[model samples]
Target: MRVTRPMLAVAGAAVAAAALAGCGSGGDAAAKVPPTATGSLESLAAEVKCKPNIQTDADTIRQAICTSSAGKFVLATFSTDRGQREWINEAKDYGGFYLVGRKWVAVGDDGVVTALRGTLGGDVEIGTDHHAHTGHTG
Candidate 1:
């Protein structure tokens, strides 16, 4: 079959749309703890010096007001990656740094996050953005 210009254009548009659709939260936004984040709350708290103060939001999310080598800020973690990926995509705008492990996301603006990211091997990665958050991930 001879592919006409219009046929090529339609195929190209369909491919482009499919590619864009694949690049999202994957499914409906349902919150849950990712496997990696199950025990990460405690670890992150210890690392960020929020040990005695870590606050859990429904056991699926953890947050704390902590101070560390990087500075003082709120550290948050999500059990599932539902919205975490999207958050990481736009984190720099809100001073977001993510350490994704399997299914969990640990977010902060501490050197520890950067350090832990190295240990992730290759989970999920986001470039540090410091323009909005004032503190860079590194």
Candidate 2:
């Protein structure tokens, strides 16, 4: 059969739909728990051999600096449902994946995201834009 542009478009759309469907869940019940309980920044920092300099900037979230064997990264905890929703919206807008749990982890590089997978209990996604360097995500 001769492949046509229209045929390719249809096939691509189908694949994308299937992928989005799968994104509904990360496939691990544990991954659904709070990121802090399982893969919180303090936990991850210890795992990666980093020390976390933590701070609470608002009632909405807690941010931290994790300087580890891997590299410096930020982590955050949301105080309310609105904060979490805002985070998801912001992430989608900037082309990132929310490593879902009781909380989320947003990293900037594939390597950092990938390395955190085991701790996070699955693959985490990175953003196309530059991640905040100072502390946890906003």
Candidate 3:
């Protein structure tokens, strides 16, 4: 059977759709939660009823410290996914709870992060304590 251009187009579209469908959920409970907003640090902070105290505002990143009845947390937005991942990797060494969105991360105590998740609707990530990995001698 000779494949036609139309046939190839249809097949390509089908493959793309399937790939998108798989990405839609990412097979995670967090994906199911609808974020109040994404894209900007302010918007994400506002979702949790926070008046952000701007910390670092730059081309590559925008970060703020916020406080509410739930607690205080640091919210940061990155310019790229790569940047966000790198930041998270380095931050994990400090050990804390994180609520992650598309290009933003909220860092705080476990309770604060969990509460942010309820409103911000993002995945919860736990940072590893560097001390635990150290080979310390008494």
Best by lDDT: 3
- Cα RMSD for predicted model 1: 10.2
Q: What ordering of candidates by TM-score runs from best to worst?
A: 3, 2, 1
Model 3 agreement with the true structure over 17-117: per-residue lDDT tens digits? 98887778554645556754586887777678889999999999999999987898899999999999999999987899988888899999998887777
Count residue pairs with overlapping backbones in model 2.
2
Displacement of the residue 109 alpha carbon in candidate 1, Å: 4.0
TM-score for each predicted model, relative to the true structure: 0.41, 0.51, 0.70
- Output the worst ten-in-a-row residue range by lDDT, candidate 2: 29-38
Residues 8-36, model 1: lDDT tens digits: 99999999888777666542321222334
Better of 2 and 3 by lDDT: 3
Deviating ranges (above 4 Å) for candidate 1: 1-40, 47-49, 69-73, 90-92, 110-112, 118-124, 127-138
Candidate 3 Cα errors over 4 Å, as ranges: 1-32, 130-135
Q: Clashing pairs in model 1? A: 32-80, 33-79, 33-80, 34-79, 34-80
- Top TM-score model: 3
Q: lDDT of model 2 at residue 64? A: 76
Q: Which ten residues in a row have the lowest lDDT in candidate 1?
A: 27-36
lDDT of each: 0.55, 0.59, 0.85
Ranking of predictions according to lDDT: 3, 2, 1
